[model samples]
Target: MMKLASLGLFVFDASTFPFSDLNRRRDWRYGAAPRIGDRDATQYLGPGDELVTLTGALVPEAGARYGSIKTLATMADQGEAYPFVDGSGVVWGSFIILSMDERRRALLVDGTPRMIDFTVELRRVA
Candidate 1:
């Protein structure tokens, strides 16, 4: 099996939790100064913010555990940054979990979800 990516100890792979889509956003900071007779002078401050969003689905029949979401929540509660690295060994940076949203679908008689779709949002801290 091929590894997709990893955030700390949580690995994204075919057997575990595989992400269907990955989105990244990078922003730059700028400052504007008022001018007497011309347009405001804009100065590039530096980098503003960086964010990453991972969306995937978890299927119990496919070996994905629902507790994995809880694990991520625990990591978020710790308020610590984790290194985001791809399968090719590219280190994105240290990031903190900003939010996680999940939707349960195809419920069973016991009220357990047959599939859980989730989105994880992360912010670069380092």
Candidate 2:
């Protein structure tokens, strides 16, 4: 319903929807990658910064949703890692753009990154 472009650093939100039907097997999140414990906590995202699973939206003051968000599994990364890092040395997880119609400006949620055996292409832009 919405067209989404990478905000360079995975800065996504409800307003950020893909232009195409992102309902594919690959587009869903399989799991997260293993992270190092020594990494600085300041560099990682806080629970508030990331979307959380909520039951209902009673408090209108906060951006709480009235639905439950499912937790994704954390699969392993056996191959080369993505070039981007969240300042924690832990690589940013990858998601396959199912039916990603680059020319038509449409993208679908394909399969998990590990299932398809591909890497998420994250880059830094100035």
Model 2 lDDT tens row, 14-74: 3222122221121222334556886433443322211111111122123322121110111
Worst lDDT 10-window in candidate 2: 67-76
C-alpha TM-scores of all predictions: 0.94, 0.16
lDDT of 1 by residue, 1-126 (tens): 788999998888866676899999999999999999999999999998999999999997887778888889999999999999998989999999999999999999998999999999999999
In model 1, the worst 10-residue window by lDDT is: 10-19
- The 0-to-1 C-alpha lDDT of every candidate, in the order given, reads 0.92, 0.24
Clashes of each: 0, 16
lDDT of 1 at 95: 95
